[model samples]
Target chain A: MLNYIAVSTIPIMIFIIIIVGVKEKKDVYNLFIEGAIDGLKIVYKIFPYVLGITVAIGLLRNTNALNIILTPVIPLLNKLGVPMDIIPLMALRPLSGAASTSLVMDIFKNSGPDSISGKMASVIMGGTETTLYTITILFAAAKTKSLRGTLIAGLLADSVAIITAIILINIGII
Target chain B: MSKIWSCIILISIIIAFLTGNPNAVTSSVMSESKIAVENIITLTGMMCFWSGLFKIFENTSLLEKLSNKINKLVLRFFDKNELTKEAEKNMSLNITSNILGIGNAATVNGIKAIEAMAKVNKSDKPSNNMTKFVLINTASLQLIPTSMIALRTLYGSSNPTNILIPVWIVTIVALVVGLVSISILNKIIK
Candidate 1:
């Protein structure tokens, strides 16, 4: 898998290097280095937000808050044909991918990878997004404030992801 | 708000534990460390690859050309008379990051886009534009969901790529909904 991605990306990388170096009259190596640095800078800036959110989520799960949230929703989701076990994942879907991933890992560990619950949760996590967090941090970085219709729109989009994930899993698309 | 939810969840867990079914709460906490480490590795790798790709694209001037081409459509979304250097940079960054499926990376760029838009939208509460941009950033379409695929691999899934179709579908739908809402809301506000 690593080899496939690496090999495929090579042509792309070389193409970029040639175009930037010759056509654009830019230093491809320096741009590569700078980009990497910028990437690290981004990670550094967001690290605090990531840490706080992760720890808060951790504490919440530790105290059974997620279960409480999931308990009522599970029946409704299941009635809609969404897997009962995937409810927690669905709830976490709009938070952070890494955070939901940690949650999904736990689900996979307990339920095992082959279980329907695990499969469905994986699909949902992979399919949906953390709309609020994305909006918050992005806006904060640029120093903008009002949400307008964004919250509604983002949540609605997440619902689409959740519903699509359930439908796909049920139909055995994978 | 989180604290209130925490208290409620804690009470419920206690109730469930007393009732003799504790697996739900127990399992959720048990899987943290492994998940955390795995995600870090996957995200780091994915971000590295994407950023690398972005730099290469930028170096080639492809991103700039693309930015200019999309400027009209982009301007329509947020009517700013004069596009600044920072705004152009932010837009290119947003586009590149979104394409690579790293919305996290795009947030900063999105903010810059909003900042540039703010200069032009002087009368409006900056928060309004900020929020709208957040929606767009959150709904940003991802062509290659590297972090998600990595998570699947970490969890030992047989077919990580199976998620591609659904992700593509949801991403596009979300983008459409987000854009429509912003446009409608802008009209209402105006």
Candidate 2:
């Protein structure tokens, strides 16, 4: 039953959305096409950002620098029972969504999606936002020069989310 | 962004040369663009599909209805005089789309909300309500986390949705922490 709901969720959502569109007398097909085009435009806009982060990450990973950098922090993480594999994800997540997505894919590839590291990475990804990205864009829109405590609060929340993910996975609660 | 990008590349190149593997850096620089494009291609399909569906939702009264319901809850977060009705409406729409996990739509509404709030404020600095709203958005509590689930399925997870409950728990924890801290900071910072 749970699996059924899990798989059917999107389809059910689509159904309700369609019903709502129809009742509202919307040009649903045309609107969807327009929105899809907007989606394409969004992807296009983010492509350069994605490419930049991807190459940066690739260089970091391919050069073994990622390991070198993490060496110092690994012992502390190990003491907390945190898996070493997810360290990159934790570090990159708040900075860039594209970078972290790539890292999550890497985690899925290396550890398998059902593994503890993969589950924790998934939970962390799902739970948190790209804090820096969102803040930059929102503040730019608002034209606010002084962010005050927004950045700190957002990062703190991200930390809490990551810790919660680790604890939940470690306790076998998920 | 520029500083962080340069720092990462600079450090990576330095480490690569020191470790005597300049070839690895060169090859990664050459090949990663192709990998990035491939990842974008994979993401594009999902983005278009969900954005298309969300657009349909936007055309209907459903989004407005949902936003109206959320507005009641969101209003309590702000002082009654701090937000105009227009800002409150946009805030509700932003929060509604965010909770629904339609991120692109959420971003559009979020920008609108912030812009609305900006017009009402007298200073260049962010107002308390603006700070609170941005923090809530940055914490980004989603009920479904649709994109993550899709990525998990694409990776052939044996049980992709198993992480759903855990994500919800974590999201709530993050949001509560965000709200509490922002409130505390609002008092101390000013």
Name the docking class for model 2: medium
Residue range with the least summed lDDT across 10 consecutive positions in model 2 chain A: A102-111
**Model 2 TM-score (2 dp):** 0.91
Error of 1 at A56 (Å): 8.3
C-alpha-based local distance difference test score of model 1: 0.61
Angstrom error at residue A127, model 1: 4.5
lDDT of 2 by residue, A89-159 (tens): 88889998877887786677667888889999999999999999999999999998888899999999999
lDDT of each: 0.61, 0.86
The clash count for each model shown is 5, 0
Lowest summed lDDT window (length 10), candidate 2 chain B: B139-148
Best by DockQ: 2
**Model 2 steric clash pairs:** none
Q: How far in Å is the alpha carbon of B69 misplaced in model 2? A: 1.6
Please estimate how well model 2 matches the true structure, expressed as its whole-model Cα lDDT: 0.86
Stretches off by above 4 angstroms in model 1 are: A1-75, A108-128, A141-145, B20-60, B76-89, B102-105, B124-132, B188-190
